[model samples]
Target: MASLETRVTEFQENLARNSVNEIKEQIKEMQKMEESQNFVLKDCHEKTQNMLKRIVELEKTDFDDKFNHITRRMIGEVVREHLTPIQMNFNLENKSIKKLVEEHAYTIEQ
Candidate 1:
């Protein structure tokens, strides 16, 4: 009958309208996620560049290569106790932990 055909057409039209709206909503959500990821990546990149610049500035300073290696004897409070007697300040960016121990070792030898 004519009434049955009319109802079926109306139902199909409603389904099509809802499907379009659902697709639009999904696209909007995906765009927001991409924007957030881009912002985080840019922030991390800037922080890394700043750290590299600081490292380059530090390498220009004088560093002692001797006695910076840490042995079993250098563990714990003994390391701090020896470093306290020196007037020198440690610039960790300029040297490794081993190099720092070498500097302290040379100081002890003297």
Candidate 2:
């Protein structure tokens, strides 16, 4: 009877030890997983920051390009508006001078 009781007590102790060891191993594995997740999260954050900066740069470039294009178009329109009448007057004077030269040549030939 005493021998059987001792065997039961030893068995219980062994089971308890095994349970404790398994729990400890699980805790260690969880800690390792947590560390791995931290690294992955850090990497994702850095990449996101880089992408955001690049997007901002692209937006700025696009805005500048649009602004420059609009400025050039406006300047060109203003120049055309200011030059149209001058061009017309120059054309009229050129025609008048040509007519006068032709008349002068005809008199000379006569």
Candidate 3:
């Protein structure tokens, strides 16, 4: 039969051991949760990087298309607004010069 003091000491030791075990279990649970959160964060980071890369590619394609459209429009406007009038006046001047030269040559020959 154990003395009263020895029984009290045994109870105290058992309580300490159970508290340690409970603390260990809590620590293991926390570590598992932390690992799961890290995995989720890594996956989210990868997805965000991919989305940013796709957006850059799309923006480059859109810029190229818009540049081409503006260039074509500017070329067409230059031809219509500046080149056509210059071409018509050149043709008229060429014909007048040719007629003057023929008239002078004929008079000189006579």
Full-model lDDT, candidate 1: 0.79
In the predicted model 2, the residue pairs found to clash are none
Predicted candidate 3 versus true structure: per-residue lDDT over 80-104, tens digit per residue: 8898889899999999999999999
TM-score for each of the candidates: 0.48, 0.53, 0.54
lDDT of 3 at 71: 100
Instruction: Quote the lDDT for 37 in model 2.
Output: 100
Q: Model 1, 1-110: lDDT tens per residue?
A: 56988989989999999999999999999999999999999999999999999899778644543234434446656877878655244645346777888999999999
C-alpha lDDT (0 to 100) for residue 15 of candidate 3: 100
lDDT of 3: 0.96
Count of backbone clashes, every candidate in sequence: 7, 0, 0
Q: Please give the lDDT score for candidate 2.
A: 0.97
Q: On a 0 to 100 scale, what is the lDDT of residue 72 in model 3?
A: 100
**True lDDT of residue 94, candidate 2:** 100
What is the lDDT, from 0 to 100, of the residue 67 in candidate 2? 88
Alpha-carbon runs more than 4 Å astray in model 3? 63-110
Candidate 2, which ten residues in sequence have the lowest lDDT sum? 56-65
lDDT of 2 by residue, 1-110 (tens): 56998999999999999999999999999999999999999999999999999999987787777989999999999999999999999999999999999999999999
